[model samples]
Target: MQIRLQKIIADSGLCSRRKAEELIESGKVKLNGKVVTRLGTKAEETDKIEVNGVLVTQPSKKITIALFKPEGYITSKSDPHHSQTIMDLLPKELSYLKPAGRLDKDSEGLLILSSDGELIQRLTHPSAGHTKTYMVRVKGFPKPQNLAPLSSGKLKLDGYLLNPMEFHILSVKDGKTWIRLRLTEGRNRQIRKVLDSLGYPVIYLKRTEIGKLQLGNMKKGEYKELSEKDISLCFKT
Candidate 1:
């Protein structure tokens, strides 16, 4: 019944599997009183496992949460620079949940956090093809012809070709243009970079949806625990 060390740590709600690997490589994880640093090392459930001197145990209940992340809060559990993190918005009893995906500090919107390692993997993995929707406000207004190339999957940034996306104008007000985009791929700062390249320079950006899970009317910095049915909505292509 031996399981991978990272999986053991992740299932114990200590951290994501990726972060568990980092902890193992940094010699912060030990198996049966001996440091085990190899990525694929395995041990049985009966064996004692420790992470940063902490004994690991599986939680009796698994929890998933949908958080309305506000701008300026880092999406990580901890940062070396001591910046405020999303964890600060949660109660101490729910500290074991890890963010499934990230929203940069400058952007605000729907963010999912979960204690289920498999759910985190499915949501973050590229193969999942989950659609994320964003509401963006940018400077100036551009013609439809100018944005037609974006939906054709011909947009390139940093020498990388992006996937086809759905982009359309939602409104225009006071010298600013509001638009919505649905993207199947999540690239680093892709929306901001794309609009900037198109000469529209984003003024504001917020993600409103992931798959069929909508942000609803949740206020910034508020979070709600998800029921099993609600969690399934995230995978409803």
Candidate 2:
């Protein structure tokens, strides 16, 4: 049976359906030796599918990796600014995998890379409401009342009102404060922006956990393949 090219790619575990659409629009996908830039193009099992000149074949096994990102590495596969990207740090065999969610160049910690489109969508989609926990170090100690807004869902910024979530102060010392924050929404530079708006500018931020997955004891720049159990726990219904 013929299926939409994007769906075929997504089901093959290459990327999420949304990213498949991007691959198609960018002219990176071809069907039966013909470039297919249209969103609704179809391909059958008999049709040859190629992405960037390499024929698409179903892998014998699907893979998911969790990487302990270090500061100064970009989350992108490639960058024009000559900055080091996470793809450069990974093994060449994982070149086909894509990051489920991005970490800023200056920030660090728990990054999930995978070929499983469905799992990627479950973790990255805002509607999933998965909580991401961060250990943040900021310049000054903020009053407990200031953090109340984080849970009260009253923190408004840039014409947007953020939902209430968990924010707990872990410690404060030497003019620096360490706090733990949990957020369900993954807005761009969200942690930084929220802290900035609170008058306690962030000095450092690292995501320590996503859902039940923790970055415990994982050395910086190291990566580990997710076990079947880990994957199952990650997507538990």
Candidate 3:
């Protein structure tokens, strides 16, 4: 069966569909040694496809892993300024894999890096409803009344109302307090902003879970290859 060239590139997990289209238009994608820049170009299974001189083929064995990202590492492939990225922490054998989503440099937790684009899409897409849980330490403890707006699901941020989430106090220590939050949406810098809006500026934040996947006891900078059974467990949560 013939499929669009971009589908083949995206299914290979090299990039998203939009990025694949960009590569095709930039004359970087070739089919059977011929540069094909037209979108919607169809290619059959037997046809050879190459991107930037390397043959494009699905991996024989699919791979996915849960990485405990430590603070200070950017969640990107590379940076022009030579900043360290999460990819630098993985073993050379897993360099081809890409992060399904992001964890900011300051937030450390369970980061799913995988080669399965379909799985990545299902887990990260907004409609998936895979709630991410975070342990947050804020500057000061706010009374329950102030925290009510966050859980009510009506908190407006920059003209956008947020999806309903659960915020609970986990512990109270001197000068700071630890709280747990469950979020349905993965907005950039959302956890900090949400808490800050409630008069509790977040000082430390770490994602503890995403769906059924848990950070567990994994130490900073540690990574574990998830088996088929292990991957299946994530959806159950």
Could you give me the TM-score of model 2 versus the true structure? 0.82
Residue-level lDDT tens digits of model 2 in 1-237: 777888778866666788889999999998888898999898777788988887776433568999999999999989999999999889898887878888898899999988776677777777887778899999888988977877887787677888787988999899999999888877788889888888889889899888778898999999999987876655432
Q: What ranking emerges by TM-score with the best candidate at the front?
A: 3, 1, 2
Q: What is the lDDT of candidate 3?
A: 0.85
Show pairs that collide, candidate 2: none
Model 2 regions more than 4 Å off: 1-6, 12-30, 34-47, 50-60, 235-237
lDDT for model 2 comes to: 0.84
Candidate 3 lDDT by residue in tens digits, 67-168: 999899999988788988998998887887888889898888889988786677767777877778889999887767878898887788878888988888
Give the winner by lDDT: 1 or 2.
Answer: 1
Candidate 3 all-Cα RMSD: 3.7
- As a TM-score, model 3 comes out at 0.83
- Model 2 deviation from native, Cα RMSD in Å: 4.1
Index of the highest-TM-score prediction:
3
Candidate 1 lDDT score at position 221: 95
Per-model lDDT = 0.88, 0.84, 0.85
TM-score winner, 1 or 3: 3
What ranges in model 3 sit over 4 Å off?
Answer: 1-7, 14-30, 34-47, 50-57
Candidate number achieving the greatest lDDT relative to the actual structure: 1
